[model samples]
Each structure stands twice: as structure tokens, then as C-alpha cells.
Target: MKALRHVLRATTVREAIDRVPEAFYERFAFAFLLAWLAAPLLLWWVGPVIGTDITFLAWVNLQVGLGALILVALRLAAHLVPPRDVSWRVVLRDELPLVLLGMFLLLAVLATALSPTAEALDGDWYRRESIWTFAAYVGFFFLASRVVSGVLRRALLAGVIALALITCIVTLVAAISAGWHTDEGAVAHRAIAYFHQFNHYGYLLAVACVLAAAAALTVARRVLRGGLIAVFGILLLTLLLNDTLGAYLAVVAGLAGLVTWLAVLRRLHVTTLLLLAAVAVVVHVLADALGVGVAAEIASLGGDMVAVSEGSADAASAGTGRWGLWMITLEQIAVSPWSGHGIEGIASLLPGGYGRPHDEYLQYAVFFGIPALIAYVSAVVVVLVRVVRRGRAVDGITVCATAAAFAYLISALFGNTMYYTAPLLFLLLGIAWAGVRAAGSELLDAESTPLAEDRTAPTPII
Candidate 1:
């Protein structure tokens, strides 16, 4: 017992953290945010110019390069600013998503270990690799949010908007050069920049569009709002060119959530909807002039949606193959209802030419078993519920975050977004935490600080 007590002690870890200044957490958070923002640009600009597609490698480089920089910044922050301690309760509360994510990852890893792959290891790693990557972002961003005060949350959101703007710029350049095709396409569009597959790019843009729109709606500064709105237009055009129906549906769902929230608050009215319509019309005219074929895309998206609903095996199905693949996948899952084969377990079992489950909920159920799927959905549901329950009194940013999350959830129904736009959405989740936590801080400041005698009553918290 004595030896066990010594071995289990947390003194060493705490001592290491203690050596670092507490004030560094906020800076570390910002530095990490900046690193992520730099990654897509590194891939899109540097990759094409250098004749390489190192999108995944760029992600890895940011983790290594920026991670070290953050460590140095942490040391500097500790010394330069006053140090304070954070309680474990705070971490547990603010980082519950990550905690739940860790649990899911652990289950996935264990499942993979227990259910060894019978087939060759060619693509057996895809599912497992995605889960690992997802876990990394959740853990990294959760920690980033943990140390910083609510003060840095807005900066983090702005960082997201910056990423969206850059992505839109890269996407527009790539689409213009590559040109859009009305014919059948590959799994991911062929012309996407900074992402491997077309759907991946589509999903990213769709989520970014939501982010940009949210920012445009709430931002007080006209210049920033205009910039965001412009970015949203660019992103919308790119999404149209990609021709991903799932992404389109997801983006609309997110927008609806935002609109509903605004309407509930009496903020959404005819002028707002009319302005949105005008923006869409202006973008459509611009797209038509640019020769991107916006009208064809609208027709194609409608046709694809109809096919999916009717389960028609047509030209669209030849491209995505989602409806049919899902049918076979559900049958496969029925045999082994629980304790699904781990990781890329589904790929080998699936019929040839079908990429993945294509649905995240189905992927979770077939890959990690039903329990993991429940947990996965629960985590997302918790965020949506939390944001909704935060009430109209919270703030515009928080409401925006909720809208973005809802849009992503709607998209997740169609793709393994956990592998793509999900990381971005997870970052938004962290920002949401920051927004809520910041509000709480203001409340704390009001209660803790002593009021001057002249000001008998404290200022109302608007």
C-alpha cells in the first residue's frame, strides 16, 4: 500500500506544471489557435507552388512546430504575468467533451485490439487513424480553453473566421483554375484545395460558411462584418461548385438553427431574411458571370437529393454510392450487433468501391458498436442542449456558436465529418465554452470586487 501510494502520487506532474507560470495558459491558447490557422494556408499555397499535397503533413507540422513554440511561450508567460492555480473541477467542467472523447477513444482502441483485422492492413488503419486524429484535436483545444480566462475566447473565434476566409480564398483560386464539371465526379471533388477529397473540402466550406454568416450577423464593426459576409459568399460559391448535396443540407440546417434562435429573440425579421435573399441573388449573378455554372449546380443538387430520397441508382449514386452502401452496411451490422470490429474494420467488410459508411452515426455503430454511437451522439446533443439552454440573455457570439454546431450536426448525418469539418466544429465547441466561461467571470467580478461608497448599487449586467 505504501509503495502503491508513492507510485500513484500526482506530485511530479503538479510540480512540473507549478514550475510554469499560470498566466501562460491564455497565451498558449492563442498560439495554438494561430498554429491551426496557419496549417491550411501552408498546404494550399505552399503545397501547390511546391508541387506537393502535404495537407495532412501540414497538420502534423503545426502540432510539432507550434506545440514547441507554445511551451516556450508558457515559460515566458509564467514569468511575465502573475501566476494562479486552476482547480480540477474547472477542468472537468469546461472540458467534459474531451473527457467523453477520451472515453470513446479508449473504447475504440480496446475494440481494435480485441477484434484483430482478418484482411490485409491496406486500409485497416483509416478508421482508427481518424479516431486518433479526432481525439488529438479535442484534447489539444480542450487544454487550450482550460488555462485561458474567458478573455481570450473571442480571439479564438476570430481565429476561426480567419481560417474560413483563407480557405474560401484558396478554394476560389483552385475552383477557377480547375473549373467545375457538370459530369460525374470522384468521392471528393477533383478541384478542392488543401483537402484530400472533394466531400472533405465541401464539408469544410459548408461549416466555414456557417461561421462566416454567424460572425457577419453579430459583429458590430461594419468592416469586419462586410469582410465576413464577403467570405461567406466566396465559400457559398465554392460549395456550389463542389456539388456535395450533404454539405448543402448541412449548411442550410445550421442557418436554420441560427435563424430560429434569432427569431426567438425577436432579432430575426423580414429585413434579415430579405437581406439574405439579396446576398444569395448577388452571389448567383456573380457566379453566373464567372462561368462557374451555378444554375447547373442547383439543378444537380436537387436531382441528387431526389435520388437519395427515392433510392435511385443513377449518375449521382455512381459518384457517392451512399444510399446503397448504407443499405448493405446496416445488414452487415445486424450480424454482429455489438462489439463491432475495430478501426478500419468496416472497410474490408464492405463491398468494393464504397468508400466508407458515409454516415458518422452508422460508422460509429458499425466500427465501435452501438454504445460508442450513443456516446458520440450524446456528446453532440449535450453541446446543442447546453447552448440552447444558455438562454437568449447570454450573448450573440454564444448563439452563433450554437448555430454553427447545429449546422455541423446536420452535416454529420451524411458524412464521416468526425474526420473532416468536425475538428473545426470541435474548436468552435471550445470557443463556446470560452464564451460561457467569460460571462461567468464577469458575474464573479461583479460579486467579488467591492463597490465604491459613492456607487452604492453596482452596475447592472446587461
Candidate 2:
């Protein structure tokens, strides 16, 4: 024991971290760890604050501010140690468009604040918030990329799964204790698991499911596979219990996207594809036969497909009618087609003081005009094109990251998920960028070394 203690004391930080097992270098892992650590406080305060119209947005804003401070501190510490060739320029290269768009919005907000029509320009809450949120995420990505160690990455992943499991368990316990039921008289026994809204819960579960699936595929050891399967089961069960149509659709879409991408690349086995197709068909038939509500109840603790649908009756009717709200938003956007109202102009556009557009694209056009929307779209398109082109030559991890990006892009169309969707978009983008960097490094190494081909084996295709 004394010898073991001496060895542990002698080990370097990196070596000690390496001994922890799992990839500790991934940003998602660290983000997940931080998020989980922060969840209880967030949950306790957010609902109450939002209920009182105190702007829970400030909570996230505070987190972003603190993250910036932490990032600077980490950078300073890194400088004291052996300097690595970490390049902020590379980060800027990938994220320049987002930065430019943010600047445009900032200018717009400033212009609106100073304008004679300043009071009329309050309709751009979504736009202003989204711009700041995007900036915060970009900052988070930079910090996470730099500070994450290999052990921390692995721990983050494991920690995220563990936290998700805990959330599921807590949700289950709460439901059981409360004996809660939906408005339609169906027991929502497991539906609200650790989340106040079904959609949020579903989104979180969907991410867990994807990560769990990735682990199942990539982890070689049987023991690890078994553990991942157990975790996957817990997450899947939580998702079903939540009964969120958007969440359900997103999960289906993500899985389908993953399989379809793999098939197109000829990386997936024909037998597995056939089996999945057969299962899908069987499930569809069963669901149809069971009646929509009954099927929903059986598949998820929540009942009624209609209840799960986006802009459901409760949501649409309760919040000044989203459709009506959107119509007003569109009218505001039409007022200034070129540069629209400034970022602050959105709130002023609303007849009554409504906060958000509930839609990202609409908010963008309303706040910064068509120019900003074009820039945002152009950025997404560039990322997509690069991902597709580079992914073909990379490993499974790269392929998965690309596929996840596609899923997020699709989901973004229906929801204001860009930055509001936690770290999903930023995390995927970071992974995709990391893959690109790795591939570039490999090519540079090959070019510099005459015997590179002999020294390094070809990167195995997914």
C-alpha cells in the first residue's frame, strides 16, 4: 500500500489522468460534467424565476461570463507550462462567419437603441438573445477544446451518462411520489423526469441515446458494451416515458441519419440494414393497429400523439398563440426587408410585450434582416459541404460527428435549438472541426516526411 501510494504520488498529472480510463480529451465530456454539476441549482432556480418573469436568460448569461473567466485562467496556466502549438487562428478560421454575424447583430442592436423608432424596435428578443448565445457557445467551444485532457474527455462522457441515469431515476421517483397525470387523464408517471417540460426532457434523452449508441458501436470490450447497453436502456426508457414528439422524431431522425450515412458510404453491413428496416416496419404496423393514443401510452408513459406534436393546443393557445405571434413577427420583418429593425427592434414590434419568436430563422430575419440570415445559412452550408467531403476519408468518429451535425441542422428547422439546445450543436461542430484538424495534420506529416507512407499506416475508413 505504501509502495502504491509512493507510485501514485510520483505519477505526473497527465499520467495520473491517463490511468483514469476513457478518452479525456473531448470537449463534450467536460461540458457534460459541468452541466451535470450545475443542473440542480439550475432546476431549482430557473422555473421559479421564469414564472415570475425574472428572465432565466440571466442565469445562462452568468454561466457564459464565468466560463470566459475560467478560459482566460486556463490559457494563462497553460502558458506557464510547456507551450503547445495550439492555434487560436485555426479556431477563428472555422468560426469567422459566426463572429461576423454577431458583430452585425451588435451593430444592429446599437443602431436600434439610438434610433427614434427605438420603442418600436423591441420585437427582436430572439435575435439579440440568439446572437449572444451563439457567441457564448463559440467561446465555450474554444475553452473546452483547449482545456480538455484525454482522461477528462472520457470522464465527461461517462459523467454525462451517469448524470442522465440519475436524472431518469429522480424523475421516476418524483412521478411515483406525485402520481401525476396529463390533462387528458393519462398517467404521466415517468414523463416529467427531472425536467419541467416534456420537450426539454426528450431532447436531453435523445442526446444520451445517441452517445450511448456511439459507445455501443465503438467500444470493443464486451464488458464495456454491457455497461453501455444498460445505460442506453435507462436513457431509452426515460425518453419513452417523456412522450415528447419532437424528441421522439429527433431520435428517429438521428438514428436514420446515422444508418443512412453509413449505408451510403458502404460502411454498414447489408444484413444490419435489412434487420433495422424490418424492425421499423413491424413497429409501424404495431403502432397503427394499437391506435395512436394507445400506442403512445404503450411506447411512452405519456399518451396522445396530438399532445406530443409541436405547437400543441396548450402551447399555442397559452402563449398569445404562436401562430398569431409569428404573423406579427413576419409583419415586423416585412417593415425592413433589407436591414429589418435592429436587434432591439423585435420587442418594439410586438403589439403586446411578448419576449421570443420561438423560431430561430424568423427571429434572425426580423432582427438583422436578410443579410444576417444569409450569413448564418452560408456558414451552415460551408460546414455541411466540408463535412461531407472530408468525412468520406476519415474514421467512424468523424462520420458520426458529421451525421450528428445533419440531425441537428434538421431539428433546428422546427425548434430554436441553435444555442438553446444546450451544447449539442457546438459540441458536434467542435468534433467535426477536430476531425478536420486531425486529417490536415496527417496530410502535413505525410508531405514533410519522405518515408511517411512507410512509417504511418493509412487511416482506416469507417
Candidate 1 versus the native: TM-score? Answer: 0.76
| Candidate 1 wrongly placed segments (more than 4 Å) | 1-16, 47-52, 58-95, 118-131, 147-151, 185-190, 269-273, 285-319, 418-420, 437-462
User: Tens digit of lDDT per residue, candidate 1, span 250-369?
Assistant: 887888778777778626645445666578678768766765544565676677778777767573363256666677678767866676766556776666855467887787777777
Instruction: Give the residue spans of candidate 2 off by over 4 A.
Output: 1-61, 69-134, 145-159, 184-196, 269-327, 338-355, 392-406, 417-420, 438-462
- Alpha carbon RMSD to native, model 2: 9.4
Against the reference, the lDDT scores of all candidates come to 0.59, 0.51
Summing lDDT over every window of 10 consecutive residues in candidate 2, give the lowest-scoring window.
Answer: 453-462
Error of 2 at 250 (Å): 1.6
Residue 321 Cα positional deviation in candidate 1, in Å, after optimal superposition: 2.0
lDDT of 2 by residue, 131-178 (tens): 445456555444433322333434445554665677777776775577
Q: lDDT, candidate 2, residue 193?
A: 45
In the predicted model 1, the residue pairs found to clash are 21-78, 188-198, 188-199, 189-198, 254-407
